[model samples]
Target: MQITTNPEGRTILVGKAIFTPDEVNQGFEQVYKDNVSRVKIPGFRPGKAPFKIFASHVGIESMKEDFTEIAARQALKEMLSGKTIRVVGNPTFEVDSFDGPLNLTIKVSFIPDYELSDPSKITIAVPKFDVTDADLNKAIDNIRGRYASMAPVDRKAKKGDFVYFKWSVITDGRASDRKKEELVEIGMEDFVKDFDKNLVGVKSGDIKIVMAEISSGQEPVEIEINIGEIKERILPNLDDDFAKTLHVENVEALKDIVKNELLEQAKDAKEEYIESMIAKALLEKTNIELPENLIESSVDDEIEKLARDLSKKNITLEMYLEKRGINEEQLRAELTPKATNQAKLDVILDDYSKENSIEASEEEVDQEIEAISNAMKDARRPALNENDEQVRKNLARIIKRRKTVGYLMGKVQLTEK
Candidate 1:
């Protein structure tokens, strides 16, 4: 057997496998042995037929196709053995010649080999945010919303008012089924179509009809609103009393604390922005070559993920597409570019990790798992065991990627603006 590889592109490989006459003869014998018992030979029982008779009965020339497959498999095994190429899928085989040397051509996808331009030479601009007094004020305002008091008001409900009411689907001319109390923050129903518009002028004990579109991609539903209580939110004045309630010294001390928090958030946001810009720059700088079948396979995985995500919401991909007025082809077209880019990035990061000998330590995995367990303690979710194979693998992948990103951050030139 002889093998020769020719790259059609950086990633797509076209190779040829040629079996010698002796090897071809051996392949025929193997095929005959494997299939002889499965076929009906006229003069003898299933496995009792001689090779020449079996070949004559089955058309000896046609057996070349079966032999080609056997040769192709052996060729691929020998050709790819000990090679570090990340094959995307099984190589496809094409018979080159059945009569001479039993030749075959094989094709497979490998993640592209790429070179990165000097990271130090690449300039990336990262946006920086300065925490101002206005930002502090906004932060304080958000904190105020937490301690806000809602008191029933006699006037007509207005914007920013809380409308505590019961609503039911009006079937025919009467209310149908049960009514549930809904506390809606008026003036924020843009997500619910015209819900707030219909309730803004209503007073306590005043009934109204609202057509609400609760979820996007769905038609509006008509419901009869039974107004119960209309209340206005009262935010406590920023004073020593408010500070004491929050376990702080005084208003000045509270302002200092909140201002410091805003500053820290701004700093964190700046770091995040820098990291994101660095990643974008790295991808653009490297501009890795992506294989078509790799892109296609990635898109397929994305589609499967889309289906799973929809299933979690009690919806199906078919339903989502129908509601969106699109087909699977159109959805695939939309997802193709994103999937392609992600696959390319994964390839580059994997290659970079290998070249740099970068890896995630067991300590990092343990810490990540501990953080996950702590985060989910409130939900009472199943505990994650760090020693679990899949858990460790997934966490290690994420951690190594972050570490790789950090390494690239050190390699690049970041300008904050």
Candidate 2:
């Protein structure tokens, strides 16, 4: 076998591999022998058929195709045996000349080679974050709101009141759906802009006709709502009683727990913020040529994740982009920089992890896998166990990346704001 490298672009290497006829003949014979036992011929019982007869039945062209494929894969495997090419995405192959010495061309993409900025010299200043009294108070307020009680009111509905009403929307001279009981918070514009306004000051048994322009470039929807009961939410006081409801000793204890939790969250946020700063600083300082395929793959992953999230809300990515008056191309273009940065960060982190001897132990990987498997439902447990190796590697990579980020973040200087 002979190999020649041709540069396709900045990050892609096109390899032309040519194998001698003798080299591929063995593979072709092996493939033929492997399939002969399964091949059915009229005059012979499967494996009893002569090689010539089977070859004649299957056609020589098919054998040549098989030989070309096997030889091309072998060439690629040989090329990557001791090479430093960090090939990323799937490689593409083209059978150049399978008639003679099975000539094949392969295109492989790799992350570009570049040196990272001196870690010791790099310094990132991040503001010191702490949970403040106001934060704790806000958290307590949220808890109080969660434990709020609702009481029916006889007067007109006001802001922050739950207004239960029977409503029907008439679009295009026809009522869209049957009259349904709907509850809306008077102040939160969960519906059209004028919906909350129409609900406000509506007394029980009042019939209100609201012509609302919910969307642009469409006729106003005629909505008829029969007002029902109004309920005002009364928040419980943040005192010992409320604390007892939450199984806490007292309000003071609850506040302490909330403050400690918020402080821990703030610490985590601070670490993440500092790590992002370090990444940005390192990106700016270093000159790296990222593989286009890696960036494209990352962009695809982002798009898929966005699609899944939007799917949960009964929306498609196309619908979202259309609502925003953009196309898939525009979305991909917007995500390109982010994807590029992510790819660069991954490469840099991997390199840093290796250089600094940062590693995820087997126990750490096993613990992560166990946590993940436990989080999964019983139905998916078997699948998780089946993909144990892949899961371990993915978890190990995540752990190593975090360790690398933490290492860099630890080196940065923090300034309190």
Candidate 3:
């Protein structure tokens, strides 16, 4: 067998496997034998039918098709064995003139070449915040608001007020007919971009129209928003009673708890920002030629995982294809870039782990297992035994990855927020 690759541009790779008559004949004999074992003739029982007789009965063309398919599958596997080829989807196979040399063409899609920079040199400014008395008070109010009850207000909506409104979003000049009613609090950064800004000074009887940009097809889309009604937030009074409701002794104790929570949140956010910065810097600093085969394989795996997840939700892959308005080829094309990025991140993280000598000890592994067991117990699930070697080994890997991330964050300069 002879193999050659033809680049079809746009990341599509065509691998042609040309088989000689000897190879084809061998495959044909195997196919005939395999079929003859299960098939029966009028006067002959299974496995007793001669190849010549079976070929005469089944027709040469039909037999050739079956044999060729099997041969192609085997040949393709052999051809791809040692190559780092990332196949975006299932290969499209074409047998060009089987009567000749049994030439087969297989098309594989994948992401083309791209380079990522090192993380150390990439500079990013992280927002820093100092925990102050006002900040602590604000955090306590936020906590209270989580458990706050809303009452029907007779006034207009204002800044720092929660508004429940019905609205429709126009995406790419096409207005959505579905009515989206969400409870949005003004001044909350968690709300979608420009949402809170549009809600300010709006009344219950008024309908406000606002425009915002949202992600659409690889670009930002200007969306027109139509607001229905707005209602002001009715926060619970922060007092001794509120503290008692939160299981705290008094307002002072509640404030302390809120402050500590805020500090922890700030620390986590700072660490996350630093990690992101480091990843960016490292990618910029290092230049590695990615294995194309790996990216394609990862994309295929991602697609299969997506299909399985959708299946669990009682949706078929066809349903997803229809919803996305894309064919299998288009879907694969879209996933190629995503898969490449994920592969790059994985490679970088793995390299970083090895370079830093990151490892989890037996005690750490045991602790992780215990933690998981406790969590499962709390969630009313079966507890995993600490002595289970497989479970411990798996937990050890997880703990090691977590510790590596923590260590990397600590290595970076973090401005506390």
- Top-TM-score structure, candidate number: 2
Candidate 1 lDDT:
0.84
Q: Using lDDT as the measure, what is the rank order of every candidate, best first?
A: 1, 2, 3
Error of 1 at 406 (Å): 0.9
Better by lDDT, candidate 2 or 1? 1
* lDDT of every model, 2 decimals: 0.84, 0.83, 0.73
Write down the lDDT that model 3 would get.
Answer: 0.73
* Best candidate (score: lDDT): 1
Better of 1 and 2 by TM-score: 2
Backbone clashes, candidate 1? 0
Instruction: Name the runs in model 2 displaced over 4 angstroms.
Output: 1-3, 18-54, 74-83, 120-128, 152-159, 165-181, 186-189, 192-230, 282-285, 303-337, 367-387
lDDT of 3 by residue, 184-268 (tens): 7788845566557877777675655565444322343444444445555567888899889888999998888778888898888
Model 3 residue 240 lDDT?
A: 95
- lDDT string for model 1 (278-328, tens) is 657767888677778888989999999999999999999999999899999
Q: What TM-score, computed on C-alpha atoms, does each candidate reach? A: 0.72, 0.74, 0.61
